[model samples]
Target: MTPDLIILADTIHTMDDPPLAGPEDSQHVQAVAISGGVIAAVGTRQDAGQWQEADTQVVDLGSATLTPGLVDGHIHPVFGLDLTIGADLSSASSLDEVLALLQAEGRHDDGWLRGWGLNPNAFGTVPLHRSVLDRVTGDQPAFIRLFDGHSALANSRALELAGIHGRLEFDQASEVVCDADGVPTGLLLEAAAMELVQRHIPQESFAQRKARLGELLRDFARSGLTGGHIMDHSEESADLFHALEAEGELPLRLRAAPWCMPGSDEESWKELARSIGTGGRRWSIEAIKLFVDGTVDNGTAWLYEPDVRGESTAPFWPRPEEYSAAVRYFASRGIPTATHAIGDAGVDHVLTALESLRHEVPADVLRRTVHRIEHIETVPDDLVARFQGSGVVASMQPTHCTHYSLADHTDNWSTRLGPERADRAWRCRDLRDAGVTLAIGSDWPIAPFEPLPIMADARLRRRSGKPDQHPIAPSQALTARQALEGYTSHAAKAAGLWDISGSITVGKRADFTAFELDPLTTSPDEFAASSVLGTFVDGQIQFMLERHA
Candidate 1:
């Protein structure tokens, strides 16, 4: 039989082993055959020739290392693109720079001026408030999101428009920062408070959302991503994705988890489960999302003890017992759940819920629908052991540790955790050694979407170059192979799509990320600086270096 395509590379990592554990490890392969968007064969160059025919369209990728397409375990595509339409404050180093950026944005004709990626570290010792933003925005109604997405700074005009008067009650500790006289300060913590101002901002029309998402997916392919586990989704997003799949070829695969809030009733949960539709061929909604707590920044994370600011530690659900009930409800039906749990207390609650549900869930179904705890920023050694055989996957982001935290344990996040818990930041090595499944991702918009730099950070425990950059718990660093697996096999397993994608095995989807250097042998410094030569999704070339020799 004539295969549709043949990809020839110098090396290929199948990710089917324990990552070069012994002298017998051999994951390198030379060629692969694709037929009907599935791998027909994978072996040495000579072995693959038996599956090829005269009409096979062979792609000679000279000296390139071909591996399974990278999978981002967690990301927010539509939301991230929506943020990009406004001023990008990610580069602003100081409060003055932030105001200058906002001032320039205010000059535009748009009714509401919006910006994203604001880092509070730029403020020095000064406290953030709406008054400062009002100086530049005036009556423009500016709302800027912090880099971590857990907090936002809104001008007084924007707050007035949203009608935020007093402190708001929420399942989590969302607060509308108040001054000495109990006046709103225009600083919103967590979604409950941020949404007050955010809801007033006009939403992107369905047409606009579809267009922007299409653009980002194409960019994702060029950056070597074949698929992503979208952390949050809506009915509109589901429809937009299916519409794109129906139109023609999609650049990448999408597996989205719809947002399931705490206050919704059981009937509502059942309705959401019923309304969930299957993706034509490239996308699907198979999981649900919940927030156990907010990020570690801004003192919103649910913790055993209060942060440096003495903020209350609370879960996102008004009644956490209800959260356990919800998990049980979904787990009984074989639906996987992904909870956003950053603090140890948050993770602890989720583990308890999973443990209670385990008794009722069948082992096979439980294994297939492994519930995940997202952004496990801090966990104790004892709690880490609970994940060993608990059928719970830890979905973590390496760049959160590298890009945001200082290795010296003096960064904002570290300072918030204090010395006692700061040392436990992103225990990737600890969890993996404890026999727990570790799935890594970029968390997109929160960090860069590229997998190479993320993998490098996982291995180095620090950013590339700059001798002054210290390693955060260097002992917790992952090996090059383990880091690669996080984005390949382990990620696919976390998403429950291991049967179809993830590795370069026969009978799997023909998705390949070709790089110029062998990732296994390359140093973290060099690998982080390398680029993708080409990307293939389901046997089709979505992106290739056109100018390359």
Candidate 2:
């Protein structure tokens, strides 16, 4: 068959073999021939002329570096649509600034005032309550989501709109956060609590959401992403994905996982199981996402011991044993899972649950299970050691460490866990050193989703832009190659799709990202600032810099 397209780059990091290996080691592979969305040939520059045909589209990324398409092991493009609505508070460093931005948005005449990406650190000594927000958004029903995505602060009007009068019980660890007088403080903790006010907020139109998603995915492609493992999937999410595909080809391929919440039962589990492999052309549901706990920053995370605030001692699931049963149900059937476990107790409970699967499931069935533990914000030495032979993928985000916390234990996440657990931080290098596959991602809307800057943060243990900042945990920093692998090879492993994706070998899918600088050879800082020349999915150019044309 005549090749559909051919791409030539100065260097191609196939990532199929050991470090520094490529398709043509003896002679740099100057050409990659693609036919029917798969790599047909990879050879020297001389072979490019022979592979060319009347219809072949050849793209020469002069002096650029080509590598396996970067995939975010975890992201929430669809859910983020709602979380990123209204004002963006990701840039505000102080509570004063947050209030000013919200006030500036002004009270919508018929709609609720909304904002997202509010950092908890901005609260400082002040408690996270709606009373402060009420000052700026009085009687307007304002709802602002914290940066963690696990909590929110609603103004009194919003709380009343949702009929949140006082403390309420939940199947999960979520709380209404009542004050000393048994009155709701407007601080909603976890998904269950946040949903109370969120459901009342005016949702955007489906057409609006679909358009936004398409634009977002194109931006993702321009940033060199060919695939993203969407961590959350709802019917609305599926609708959005299908609608985008109906209009045109999705810029990036997506593999999504629908959530299995605390109140779900056997029937719900079965329903989630049935969703597997269902999708449009470029998107599919391959796994189930569960949460063992919330986040440390909100004091909702299930830590081994209580945080300084005396919170975080409980698991998200009311019955921890039921969680293990759910895991076993999936594992025995060969279905994979990606669980969000942020605290030590949460991680331990998840690990212990997986460990029990060995005695319950047959060896062959167990061997086929590819379970992952996400966030892993803080874990003790013993829990970190458990992953070496456990076959559990560590799906972590470096920016969660570099962007959210501080070395001085001053950040909300660190201060909550206290010094001892804070010292553990995100042990990316330790997990890798312990023989665990550590997959990196942005957890977008929480952190910037650009792969290069995230990779740089993985190596620096601090943001690339702030060189003077002290590293959170220097020992946890990943090596240059390891950082790249986190987004490439290791990411595929996290999704159990390495055999078909992840690398540039012949016969594999022809998904690739071409960058102006070599990720492996360039310093992390320089690589983070570099530009993408092109990104391709299924052998089609999803995004190519206009300048390249």
User: For each candidate, what TM-score against the reference?
Assistant: 0.96, 0.97
Query: Which pairs of residues clash in candidate 2, taking residues 3 or more apart in a chain or in different chains?
Result: none
lDDT of 1 by residue, 1-549 (tens): 469999988777777644443421334478888999999887778876787788899998978898899989998897676556577887887888988888777644558888888877777677888888878876788888888987899889998999888777765557898998888988898777888888888777777778888888988888889889988877677688777877777798888888778677799789767645465577788788888888777877888998888853877786888888878888887888999999999999999999987688777777667699999998888889889888799999999999888877767788888888889989999988887778889888988888888999999999875447889989899988889889898988898777887887779989989998878899988988888888998899999987534
Q: Lowest summed-lDDT stretch of 10 residues in model 2?
A: 18-27
Residues 1-549, candidate 2: write the lDDT tens digits: 589999998787788745445446623876789999999988877888988999999898888888889999889999899889878998888889988999888866557888899998987788888889888876678889999999888989998999999989888888999989999988889888999988888777889898898899989998889999899999999888878888899998899988988878899899889999999999999988999999988887998789998989989999998888888888888889889999999999999998888999999987766899999998989998999999999999999998889999999888888899999999999999999988999999889999999999999999997889999989999999899899899988888888888888788899999989988889888889989888999999998887724
Q: Which lDDT values do the candidates have, in the order given?
A: 0.83, 0.89
Q: What's the distance in Å from true for residue 454, model 2?
A: 0.4
Q: lDDT at 231 for candidate 2?
A: 93
Error of 1 at 137 (Å): 1.2
